[model samples]
Each structure stands twice: as structure tokens, then as C-alpha cells.
Target: MRKLTIVAIAMMMIVLTACSEGNKNGQGAANDNGKAAAQGQDAKAGEAGSDAKQEPVTLKVLRAGITVTETEFNAYLADAIKEKYPHITLEWVEAPEDVEIEPLITQGTVPDIIIASTTAATSDYERLDLVEDLTPYIEKYGVDLNRLKPVVLDTIKTYSPEGKLSVLPLSLNLPVLFYNKEIFDKFGVSYPKDDQSTWDEVIELGKQVTKQDGGVDFIGFDVNGPRNISTGLDLNILDPATGKSTLTSNPGWLKVFNVLKKSYEVPNYIGADGRYQYANDDDIFFNEQNLGMLAFNLAHLIGPLEELRQQGIELDWDFAPFPNFTENLGTNRSANVHALLVTKTSKHKDEAFQVIANVLSDEVQEKLARTGRIPTIQNEELEKLYGADIPVLQGKKIENIFKTEPRKVIKPHEFESDVRKFVDGAAKRIALEGIDVNTAIREAEDNVNKELQTLQTTR
Candidate 1:
């Protein structure tokens, strides 16, 4: 792999996990907004919908998001948005995670406005001509562009074909390699630390540390890779600039396999059920203590920690940047692309635009930071929204992740998550099942490519 590839992986940011409806690429921190909302008072700079409305009118909107089991800040934000503009009755048309949302769009059962990363499957939906290009309306409304972080602005640009943003990105997590301090201390091995490292070193560390403590088998490390193996592909299998999977072709893949598959017979870590299953990436790492080193979405960590905390179970850990594939590939990242798409069907397009404007504001971003979310509207002035004097902007700086870069769309129906699943399954096979590294990669590549090809044929 090129040096840029290493840097990308080492610096890869797992941007989400939370009260989030779907796809938190990073780990979870604290919710600054939840803290604010708990106060039950509106923000001083809350949605300024009245100013934009020429007169009172109900602005109907269609939404595309998961019907979360627990709606934290999301439910509150919905209420706040409605309160900000009483004329705008924001209809949140959420769907189940496993169900396909395209059919609703086809049948005109979709909401007027949509909010979810799933909409990024615009290419698939575009074939159906479902999403409306809101470029002219956006320019006419003159939304507060200055409020957004420049890197986030660029991410929006990636979705837009002609310098027009497609969705309003809200929260993101900067992925980092988290270590269990207690586990490392007990094993008497110093924990890995650096902005980056090579996969070789990570394996060496894992090999030395895999052991049993009080009858519980502990893995030296674990990663929520594509197929469940620790192949570094979970970090960044495809280049953002080029929409191609680089598993079998990259040197990093080899190293990822060698280290993650530390044990040919067993997975690096056990699961919540005590089995080495490759379900929810961060859950196994946090629940079992089966893993010592974990590369996961930052937000994913928070909920597990919260549950453990509630049960009075103590959790110990800290984080570092992902290891570099090669020193020259100075930065590495696992990318998570989240976007907010304006529904052409929205009656209150103008008011919805205003709510989106606030979503990208530093005031709201500060809340994201406290919750351990890297904000889309980061700036020097952005402070933590959870406390009067807390700072949240620093979280973005920690992982070298500044923006939500748009990744090239692989060929599977955009809605298909098979690519992620393929990587997860393939990585685990190579690591635990003693599969030939090259062969495993080829199989995964083939599988992903096949899925992509199938999408094209369907189209």
C-alpha cells in the first residue's frame, strides 16, 4: 500500500455509535446536548425558524432514519425543531433498520425531508429519481455556510455534483485505538501509544499478551474488521479518492491478517455471550475484556460503558491513533460518511434548512464534542456544550479526523451493507480460521465485487 494508505488507516476515524439511528463510525463519549436538554430549556441560538418564514404555514417533511429504541437527543431535537417553528410540523418518518426504504420513496410514502446516512445510497435512489436536487433552493435560502467546519463543508461537497451539498451532516466520531489500561497493566506489557504504528507491532503485542485470567481468555487485541478478522481493511479498505477495495492489493492487508489472526483456532476476543462471534464490533471488545486492543467507532464505546457503569461494572481504557500500515503512510483512517439530505417533498424546505443550519452550529457541535462526537461545524471557538466551561473541539483534533470525506461508492446496491459484512467475515476467517491470507482476501474481494456487479445488473 502507498504511504497515504497507511496514514489513512492509522488516522482512520470510527465516526459514530450512540443514540444515533445508524452508522456511528466512531466511539461514544458524553452527550453535551443531552445534558443541555436535561435542563429543559431551549438554547439561546435554537432554530431561528420564525425569521425565515414569511407567514405561518405547516411545512411537512418526510424523514428517512431508523426508529431508534431509545431516542435521546434525537427525540428532543425533533421537539426543539418543532418548537422553533410551530408552523413546521416535522414528520419524522423513520423505518426499521433491516427494511429497504427505497420502496417507500417509489410509492411516494416517503417523508418530505430525510435525515440519515442511508440516503447516501443516492446513486441507487437517483436511478429511481427519488431525491430532488435542492441546489437552487439552497442558494436562494442563503443558509449559514459559515457555521460549518471547512472539512465538513468539503464532505458535503463530495455528495454534491455541482458544488451543492446533498445532506446536512450532524455527528461523527474520530476512531482511535483504545486500550484496556488494567489489562495491559496486569499482563505486564506496556500499552501501545502513538499517533500511528505498523500492523506488525500490533500483532507482536497481541501475540505476547493473549492469555487466560481467572478462566477468562483475553485476546491481545481485536478490531471490528469487515468480516470480523482484524485485517486492517476495517480501517480503510477503499480509498476516498478512488472507489475501489484495496484488500488483496495492499501490503497493510497482509499485516492486518498476520496480527489479527494471532490464534489460528480462536477469534481474538469472545463475545457478550462468551462465544467468539463477529456481531456488533465494539460490544465484544468492551463486554468480554476478551480484547485488549480495539479499533472501533468511538461512540460505540459509550453505550457499553454506560451499561457497565449502571451495573456498577468498572471499565478501564484509553485510546491512541490507529497504527500506520507503513511509516510513510503517515495517516490512516476508517471512514464513516454521514449525510443529511433535504427532501424535495418537504413543505417547509425553508424552515428545515434553518434547523439544519443549527445542526452545524458550534453551539450544537460543542454538545457533540462532549458526547465524544467529532462535530461537522468544528472551529477554534467551539466549546463543549455540556458544561459552561468545558471544551469539545479537541476531540476532533485527537484522531487527526477533521471532516466526513465522501468515499467512492462500491457497486453493491447503495443500500446493501454487504461490503462491510464481507470485510468483517473475511478478516475473521483469515485471523481465526487459519485461512490463507491471500485466498481469504481474494474471496472477500470477489464477494464484494460480485455484490457490486449484481447491483449494476439490477440497475
Candidate 2:
């Protein structure tokens, strides 16, 4: 595995070098607006209702990450596409990671479509121009963008240039508060409500439940942080206007940290050795039955619980909307969605888009949602039907998945990664090393600026 990873990285370097050359040749920096405008004109000629000749073509599909497999794709979406366009054939190619496809793109052998994690599609790929702007295709096809959840669409747009949605999301992970109902019931504490819960109120509730009861050590709340919580807080770690670090200056960030500080400071929440009182998060929540609540994604509601049941343990759990900051109430956390993008180099742009449109249709969305893959669609009626195909989630409060609106993300730079690391480290300092929150934030701010300066100088 190590050797394969090394080879993958080495291959990626060569591919990137080749792609850099291709980009310099002018094909890579093609203006997205031009494409959107041209596609819009073409779309006018070829509306979905129009009797346009459907061409026979084969589309090469590249699945970049483990988010979806060819087996699953073939089962869920392949035949549906055929039913819509019998002449268009999909050639599916799955890569262990996205970088493996860079070689093909560099060789002028681009796949018609690329499906990947938002992280891989947006940041990991350096050549944004190679990914086609889907705005025109969407307009031409008359694909209803609003049918998808607003937050998911907003996140996809963040990856585009000039606010053009170059990629269309398929599945999304919405952050929410997952709680073990049995634990709440055992403590006689009221469950967190969707619309009314605030961070301060939730923390107070967590304190009341964080206790040793009947020989079981119950933790009021546990979450994997600070990235997860920071995202939920909708805290802008960077100044979007200037694309600079706001580690110390963002007042909202301090409030977020304050809430997290209170969480870790709950008596007996963390052991003296800087670990949870129980063995681990899964064990603490699933087996020991002690964790009262966890802030997590919708996907966790399906896979992890199923795994525990297979191990002869079952958790009586439900989820609520992620608690909001008092000031940021009603604002949703950004959806980290897995989206599909059309490659600019594809000869079958129209056909590629047809496939995408078909996938995002209400019918397909419902089918995907039933598999515990949350659909990007905004239909509230669909909420009642989520996890319908998954037997384990039959009676679960899947409605919590859509509790909050999706938060919009600011444009991010590579330096934002450094800022996240610095702040996350500061969080550790506050929780484990007993540093003052303000002092830690200030130190983190200085350290991040220095790091950014070093990065700039080196560049």
C-alpha cells in the first residue's frame, strides 16, 4: 500500500507538470462565461422539450474517490440513463483517487464526466479550466437547480469561477446533532429540539447529563473537532473579502470556541490523560451507551449504526438540527457534497449533461436517498421518505437531516488549510494543555500569519 501511494504521488507530479504545459497552451484557461453563453444559446435550440436528435455516443466516466463505486453506480444510475438515452453508453472507470486521472487529462484523454468528493474536485485539482462550467448546460437543459437543496448548490458554486456552478452535486452530508435517546431518557432530560436549541442551552443540557450514573460514565456530548464543530459554527476562519486569516478577529469564532471549551471542560468528559473517559467515540456511544449526543453528518446515521448492530450492539438514537449560535440562528451548516463535473475536453458535452440531469431528477434523487445517500433535492416531502430502502433506518428521525439550511462557504485558498491546522492545534492547547482561550487565539493568529508569510516568501 505504501509503495502504491508513493507511485501514485510520483505519477501525479509528472501529470501535473504535463497539465501545467497544457494549461499554458491557452486551452486550459478558456473563459467560463464564454462557455456558459455559448451553451445557453445552444440550450435554447435544444430544450429538453424540443425534438432534438439524440446522438449515439459513449461517455467515459471517472470516479475519483471511494465515495462511490462502479458497482453501486451501475446498480443505481446506469440503467436509468440508458432508459432515457438508449444510444448513449457510459464507460465507467474507477480510480483509487483523483490524481490517477490527471495523467489521462494531461495526455489529452479526458473523461466525459468526473465524480469526486468536493475536496478532491475543488482544491486537489489544480487545473480548474479542465472542468467544464455546467451553468450553460443547466440553463439549456432547463434543469431545475432549485430542486436540489440550496446549501448543496451553494457549496458546488463555491468551487466555480465567477459564481458559475461548474459541478452538480449528487449526494450531500449535512451536519446534525446525533443523540442516544435512551441516554437522554435515562437522565430524565428533555431531548434537544430542532428549532429552539442554541449552543449555550445545549451545553448546559450536556452538563446536566455528564455524570456517572448507576456505574456507567455518561458523557453529555462528544464530537470530533475542531474542523467538524468549526464548520457547524459556520465560522469563517478566513476573511472572505481579503482571503486572509481571521483566527483572532472573528468574534463568531471566539463564541464557537467558547462553546467547545465548555464541552471539553464538562466534569469527567475528558480523562486526565487527554482522552475520552471511554475507549473511543464509537465504543463510548455504541457499546458503553454513555454518550448523550454527538454533532455529526447524516451519513453516520446509516453505516456506523449498522456496523454496531452486526457486532451485537444496538443504540437507540435520534438526531436533531445542529445547534446554532444565538446570533447565527436559522443559518445552516454548509453541505459537504459529492458532486459530478463534466470535463471540458469531452466531445459529448450535451450528452454528458443529459446524464447529469437524469441523475439529479426527482426520481433518481428519491432512489439514492432511500439508500441512505441524502439527496441534494429540496423537496420537504422527500424528507419523509429518506432511508426508506434502508431497513435499519426505517423508524429513525431522518427528518433531522434537513433541519437546517446549508451554510454558504467563502472562497478558499490553499493557505486556508494552514489556518485550519493552526486553529485546530490551538483548540488542543485550550482543552488538553489548559491554555487561556484568548491567549491561544492570539498566539494562533500570530503563528498563522508567520506561516503564511513563510509560504509567500518561499513561493
Candidate with the greatest lDDT versus the true structure: 2
TM-score of each: 0.69, 0.78
The runs of at least 3 residues in candidate 1 whose Cα sits more than 4 Å from the true structure, single-residue gaps closed, are 1-76, 79-86, 91-94, 106-108, 118-121, 124-128, 144-147, 226-281, 328-330, 381-429, 442-455
lDDT per residue as tens, model 1, 1-459: 122222222221222222232214332232455434423323333333234535665444333342222232343245445545555555445344444666776776755555555334354445455556656545554445555555455555554555445666665444556677778888798877555666566657766677777887777764444333332233345543454667777776666665555434343354345444332445556576667787655554544554454466767766666654563344444334455565666556666666665455433455455444556654543333321211222232343332223222222323245466777677667654658777887898888777767765785
lDDT of 2 at 245: 79
Task: Give the alpha-carbon lDDT of every model.
Answer: 0.51, 0.67
Q: Least lDDT summed over 10 consecutive residues: which range in candidate 1?
A: 4-13
- Those runs of model 2 whose alpha carbons end farther than 4 Å from true positions after fitting are 1-58, 69-72, 95-110, 126-128, 185-189, 212-217, 276-284, 287-289, 307-313, 345-347
